[model samples]
Target: MARQGRHGATRRQPKGVAFDRWLDRVVTVAVLTAMVIGLTAVAAHWLL
Candidate 1:
């Protein structure tokens, strides 16, 4: 077995945390929007 230290642990950002949260939301929305658009396009192609 091996021992883990602080150097090998994940570190949290201590600055601009609010901006990071906002960016995460924006990215999630963008990804969902793209998925919807792609599915709509495929459905339209098959139906028409």
Candidate 2:
């Protein structure tokens, strides 16, 4: 197998790390918020 250069690995022809990090944070925050909301709903259902 041929090894690719760091830049070659990027799907975007001209790539920067800032986009990837921002995307990761956004996804993480969204998933966590969803989980919290789900748990809250379940708790309210059982407790109320």
Candidate 3:
């Protein structure tokens, strides 16, 4: 049997879980890329 939450029943679906994992990876990569870009910009500014 699936677990019940406060509002309703909750079940872990395989497709939903896989999608969540993929989305997490994409978001993590985007954040890392943004951070690297910002750091490079700062370094360039300091050097120039």
Candidate 4:
């Protein structure tokens, strides 16, 4: 039963468009976090 449940979960996982959308979200968040940190560093440099 446990093995079957694992197989079912994997089988039901997303594909194609859904996977692309998921990857896009991950990349966007990563980029935004980088930008925010970069901007903060620049601001601190200018202030000091």
Candidate 5:
């Protein structure tokens, strides 16, 4: 039997992991913003 030509390695695409990482970053930023706003409001009310 004869062998086939062009035995190159295939490239892999990690779209799922990339999307998950992006989603986590977005959620972390949103949570941090909410916490900062809540703390500022609480401090203002307590000082008044």
Candidate 6:
């Protein structure tokens, strides 16, 4: 069961104080893309 109390269901704030919606999505996408590229490079290096 979900916990319920007087201070329950409170919205959690983002840790990034300066980030906004657009920047958040952009950063996520960029990070994911970079990770994919890095992993592909490692795999290619191992294969060749």
RMSD (Å) of each candidate, 1 decimal = 5.3, 5.7, 5.8, 5.6, 7.0, 7.1
Per residue, candidate 2 scores C-alpha lDDT tens digits across 1-48 of 998867755575346688988999999999999999999999999999
Model 6: lDDT of residue 21: 74
Every candidate's lDDT: 0.94, 0.89, 0.91, 0.86, 0.92, 0.89
TM-score for each model: 0.70, 0.67, 0.69, 0.66, 0.67, 0.60
Winning model by lDDT: 1
> How displaced is residue 13 in candidate 6, in Å?
10
Stronger candidate by TM-score (2 vs 3) = 3
Residues 1-48, candidate 5: write the lDDT tens digits: 988876569756676988989999999999999999999999999998
Query: Candidate 6: which stretches are off by over 4 Å?
Result: 1-19
lDDT score for residue 31 of model 4: 100
Misplaced by over 4 Å in model 5 are 1-15
Per-residue accuracy of model 1 over 4-43 as CA lDDT, tens digit each: 8678467977899999999999999999999999999999
What's the true lDDT of residue 13 in model 1? 78
Poorly placed runs, candidate 1 (over 4 Å) = 1-13
Return whichever of 1 and 3 wins on lDDT: 1
The residue-level lDDT of candidate 6 at 17 comes to 48
Please write out the lDDT profile of model 6 over residues 1-48, one tens digit for every residue: 997857758877787746787799899999999999999999999999
Q: Number of clashing residue pairs in every model? A: 0, 0, 0, 0, 0, 0
lDDT of 3 by residue, 1-48 (tens): 998866647765676888899999999999999999999999999999
Which candidate tops TM-score?
Answer: 1
Answer with 3 or 4, whichever has the higher lDDT: 3
Off by over 4 Å in 2: 1-14
> How much is the lDDT of residue 7 in candidate 5?
57
- Provide the lowest-lDDT 10-residue window in model 2: 7-16
